[model samples]
Target: MNDHDNNLPAVPEGDEPVPNPGLPPHHWRPTDVDPKAEKRAERQVAAFFGVATVALLGFFVSYFAFQVGDNWDTIAGLGASNLMLGLTLAIAFLCIGIGLIHWARKLMTDQEIVELRHPAASSEEDRSTSVGLVLQGVDDSGIGRRPLVRNSLLGALGLVGLAPIIMLRDLGPLPGDKLLHTIWKPGMRVVRDVVGTPIHVSDLEIGDLVNAEPAAIFELDDEGHHVVEGVELQIAKSKGAVILLRMEPGEITPWKGRENWSVEGIVCFSKICTHVGCPISLNERTKHHLLCPCHQSTFDLADNGKVIFGPAARHLPQLPIEVDDEGYLVAQSDFTEPVGPSFWERDKT
Candidate 1:
């Protein structure tokens, strides 16, 4: 305002605004005119791409160099496997971004081009003009003239693309035999689920139902540590989970050699439903029938946990139990069959 105001001659009171001054003069960069500066910039862009390639290589090396549970491979409490992967992958991505930006800002054309807006349905002459302009812009990008920068960028992109494929190996293997077993064993006390106290046979009266789990999970070693913690404990509780019921021993129709599997009038059966692995606990006390809440499948708990009605194909597995010296109910051993839904390749017979 001040520069224009001082240079202008005084105007009449009711005249129009002063004549407009157009854009300022353009400032040219050394690379825009000097051959030496342009060559230096081309090399600099290539160097950035080269660094990206090295970072990608480091990503692969870090993946194989560190094992997941190794005792010594740690950085700031994170596993070396995780820490190295994050850092190397971050650097790899950052370098590519920086290289593309530098190439666009310095080595590419600095001239400003303008186009006016037109109708959406362009005439043939306008369409031809656009195609020619696109070809001319491609020529200005200097890909043919700059082989080093172009080749380095392509190599960097190709190497970075393989990172995901290499890490796919970490999906690891299946559970194998782990899913077929639980922590229940001979003499493992039947404990109340949340309270973790061993259940005495005398404490449960006739027609009582108790949701129970294995005591091995709550057991402590010499150092006062849990014998089973974390995922192993969770798995044990899920598979070994059962509901204890007290019925008249005279009413139970045990199959073949399972006559002594129960204690007094108390019996235990797996809480997992056989159809789709849902947990079953709802009971019809008078009929001694256990019902699955998910799909209403019912089992006769009084008759060797046999399927009485609904969708379940197999019987609910019964755990053999006996009274210990302290009168607490304990497992004679593990379940004789798998407790959950049928799996593919399972021997149904």
Candidate 2:
């Protein structure tokens, strides 16, 4: 009585505060109590799996239906093949994921259990128990017992793998000798890009850098027939692309064979970078240096486009130029050497 009286003086037993009321009442799911409801859920999950199978089949059909290259058109300019393939595969995976979630929530055992926190280090017994739980989960998944579902899912996944292998065909016909040449031919007129105006030697002044393409690129007959189109046009334009620069004649140190290649201080070189094929136009007029923004590879336009600095391993390819009888700038010939990065097949001659 003495101990109880001393402790109870601060708060009377009749006035003690009430403890918190916890979470809301738990309601049993329809599937938990109704056998018919559970069966309906199982049918819904199976239907989802069936829909996923159809979506995967659609992916395969889309892959073969679309053709590659110029004749290929797109839906609103979005590649039709890519759009269809991506949509179908995404739907297939989504259906499988949704089906699994529905199966777990509606069909699998859903009883709630409380797990107490433990010390950071686990005993050997606890580790073995954890491993056993994982193995039990594997057995419960029914992946081994249901041969039809397992085989069908495996078949769908295997077919998905083929999509990438089929895409390997896009890697190429191998560049071969294609990069070595462009539409640039002997006497082909050099024209201003976009405007398609033929460039005259007199039109350029010292310290000027002009982005130019071959006149043949814009040429069309009276009947609107292009001399080249489709793949051929793309290949030729890629190789033949060039930049024209004009410096004081005294500023240039022409290589022996290229002495007459320039007209009135105007020289031309391949716009493609020797480092990695990035088109370059950043020109330092005062130093006669052209810089590639991609890797900062610099070339001395005054000294045969020799790599003066940065990571460029080779010189930019020079396009020999001469003024034709009509006074329009024309290619003296194709680049004596290949343009862009150095390759194994490059013969230094």
TM-score to true structure, per model: 0.56, 0.57
Error of 2 at 55 (Å): 3.0
Highest-lDDT candidate: 1
Clashing pairs in 2: none
Q: Rate the local accuracy (lDDT) of all candidates.
A: 0.87, 0.81
lDDT of 2 by residue, 258-324 (tens): 8998888998999999888899999998988999999999999999999989988889989999988
> Relative to the unseen true structure, what is the C-alpha lDDT of residue 325 in candidate 1, on a scale of 0 to 100?
99
Score candidate 2 by TM-score against the native: 0.57
TM-score of 1: 0.56
